[model samples]
Target chain A: MQIQIERIEHIVHENESVKTFFIRGVNDPRPGNYLMVWIPGSGQIPLSISSFKNDLCGFTVKRVGDTTAAMHNLRVGDLIGITGPLGTSFSIRGERILLVSGGIGIAPLLYLAIEARQMGKKVYAICGFERAEDIIFEDVLNGLLDELVITLGERTPLDVIHKLYEKRRFDHIYSCGPEPMMKRVFDFARSSQLGAEFSVERIIKCGMGICGACALPNGMRVCKEGPVFDLEDMEGVWG
Target chain B: MVDLSADIGIPLKNPLILTSGILGSSAHLLKRVASSGAGALITKSITEDPRVGHENPTVIEVSEGLILNAMGLPNPGVDIFLNELETLEAVNLPIIPSVAGYSEDEFGRVASRLEDAGFRIIELNISCPHSTALSSKKVIAQDIDKTRRVVNAVRSVTSLKLIVKLSPNVTDIVEFADVAIKAGADALSLINTIEALEVDPYVEAPVLGNVFGGQSGPSIRCIAQRKLTDIALAMWKGEIERVPLIGVGGVRTPKDVFRFLLLGADAVGIGSSILYEDLAIFEDVIEGLEQIMTDKGYDMLDEFRGKVISQILDMTI
Candidate 1:
């Protein structure tokens, strides 16, 4: 695989912790396909293709492991080998859609929302976080979202989702976030009979299909089968 | 009447063997072992090609689990592995050769060599984390047709008992296992690695050359167990007696081994831990099983298979 040094054009701290890396994909991977952004000597890790308009792609990361730790140390012009848009993608386009995000989960949804906006879809968003500052993508997300709600941690676990549903319904619900939050969102969708699509925030290893890391509650691999799923199937995940 | 002792399938008292990849990446390496002792040994995934695998930083340890990989399917390959076997004594312990190949023709060719040259059984690797031009290990295990195609192709050409390795890195493991069995698999290995990855906060990149890879170690065992238990349930529910399922993934202790057997595994493949310990772990595991088997008043290993899991989880009529 070809590796490149993506100069960190800028670092956007969406929350106090999670940061979004806007890297230039050497091979120009599409949104949904992640990159194994290589660090000089530390190691490589998989990051979702948060946004892919040009050769540039976005990766939202919460400080996690060694390589990521090393990454947290790097600045502009430090190069890394990028290896993937690996696995599959739900590069779907539509005019009518509901988009949802929690925490750093908005990265991929931001890119997806960009597509919906580009397509002139009346986009709806439910972006949740712990506090006001923890919310990333507020500015970019605001313009892309037709109907948006930022669910901060003030209320109970799922009170935000209840408020969103209390308002209006849409053709689809696109989502990503913590397991419990996603579980509740999907659970609500299932119980209420909302036609929505959700993606699990899987802790992946080989963006490839081999490792069992991103396993569903039922023991299925989430990498290959999904990052994006509907209520019909999300019902069986993360129990 | 069935000549149970005559069969003596595994001399290791417990029905479970740290089937391949548990220990013994090399004869000298699996020199000693400890922890949740099991019975027997199945070596790591060795292929006919000497692969370099992917770059380092291959493995990443995480919160209850880990994601690692060298892209390193990079084994010594068959020729050298076969050569290495010569200096090695017949591991008075049971040894089933775990072989991986890119195609059926290759799998058959390798199995034929192992059968003629050595090894009593052959475990076929149909799944592994691989690198794509763009990413690493992005593909899920196998589609229905590829699963059946590879299993059937290898089975048709081999006379020795064949064990097809199933991918836990899949949507429906039971469904895939069923296909392999129907295609003539003698035994099945449940759940390979889970596909996983990690990323950096500052650099905004992945940690490995291959973006994502299979996750192994203690954390995955529960998922493995759930899948294994389900596979067992399906086998029992469907009465698939002819095809035996060997449970693997996340087995660290004798109790875990016992649990796997109870959950319905003719044998269990021990991985990860053996990496943390020594090779002779086979002896330790076997010793433990001997005590448990005797305590249970079970005369044979078969008696324990699925007994524990069935009693606990089989809430059916």
Candidate 2:
């Protein structure tokens, strides 16, 4: 796949350190599919598709490092190179779904909520962040999801999932976030015997699976086999 | 039944080698490739010290089956890598650790450690085209003296089989192959990705972060074949000592493997094609090779190994 230079049509300042960029060019990317976004001088990094509507596609980025910091500086009409809609997307299953997200991991899950709701699946989400400022897509998730729970600081998405488990049940759970938090979610799903999928992040060098920089312990290339892996694939990986 | 085994210093069940630097970073990944039906596995080039490598945009697909990468040999360094190697004892296949360094002493030190760690075969990567971090901006394989010195440095420290991977960017690959062999290389794998650059028309800047990266994949197959044929022909005509050759670059099919074996390669390395086909490419190519062998009525690789070279020799004579 070649890099397609697309001009940023819009930018959403999600928070102090996170922003969502809307660009034209990504075609029909399912939720959980990522794009290798290239910032001219800084380099390329994979970003999850936060939103895609008609011709415009959005990438929500957290300014953690050089590439993302570069992405933060980009504005409307600035051209950035992109190659993706890559990796396996989340397979919407069951009548109801719970999305567990931490920090910037909420990006793809937000997209997932929009798509799942359209298909008549009841979407519930537990979005966790280090601080209130770190939280994003709150209003959007509230409008789209059947129920949205925001967790801050000591209270994690797992804590909410544990609390919510007593009151209601979800047919499926999807998580994206820091590895440890996702591991907790995966464990919850495994123990609960609920079907679940988690989107993971790695040092994705080539974004095409050949580089192997993003390989999980299971020998699956996060770029190709998945950024989103089902519970079975997550065995031993998180365990 | 058709056999696909070959002995390139080490006996292999097949001739498909998981080329160095694709997915050799960790022991788990290596173990994964080990089960993927590869005859042998070469680790990512391990340097003396950990290298962060180039900034992102380190690799880009120029087109389908063509990739440009300048990873700058980012490795966890030999010490940490040895820890990973310790777990590979159960992997079952020949695991060759590829080593790289800035100088002869560094090469010797790294090779000696791997030797002490019980690795029997080492692929000296003196051909990384985009390794500008080396003291000399130019790659070692591009210089005959540097190539010989590095090979000799490793050879002096360890009695293990040294497979010197040479650069295709050089004018005469046979000369370097000769020097490396004379300097004590037991086997040879070629050619490393050709040095090339891709500029984004819209961005008007280099595509790769390193500005220039090594080009690999199906597009460079003809170039790699020609380079491999040169050294193979040289060995045929007694210009260089006969060492097992690992033909690499753009090998994605049974036909590619057949051509490499016919031209005089004991094994063929699959690197960039993994980007397109994943680990299954190994089985796909091997199964196709078996099919081709069955159709051709050949029971073993030796039946047609270097057949093209022999044909060329016949015509020349």
User: Highest lDDT among the candidates is held by which one?
Assistant: 2
RMSD in Å for candidate 1, one decimal? 20.1
State candidate 2's DockQ.
Answer: 0.79
For candidate 1 chain A, the 10 contiguous residues with the lowest summed lDDT are A205-214
Model 1 bad stretches (over 4 Å): A1-239, B1-13, B30-38, B64-67, B131-141, B239-241, B275-300, B312-314
Docking class of 1: incorrect
TM-score of 1: 0.53
Worst ten-residue run, lDDT, model 1 chain B?
B1-10
Error of 2 at A108 (Å): 0.5
Task: State the lDDT of candidate 1 residue by residue for A130-184, as single tens digits.
Answer: 7887777777777667777777786633676666656755656677777777777
Under the 3 Å rule for N, CA and C atoms, how many clashes does model 1 have?
60
Compared with the true structure, model 2 gives a TM-score of 0.97
The digit string of per-residue lDDT tens for model 2 on A67-90 reads 788889987989999998999999
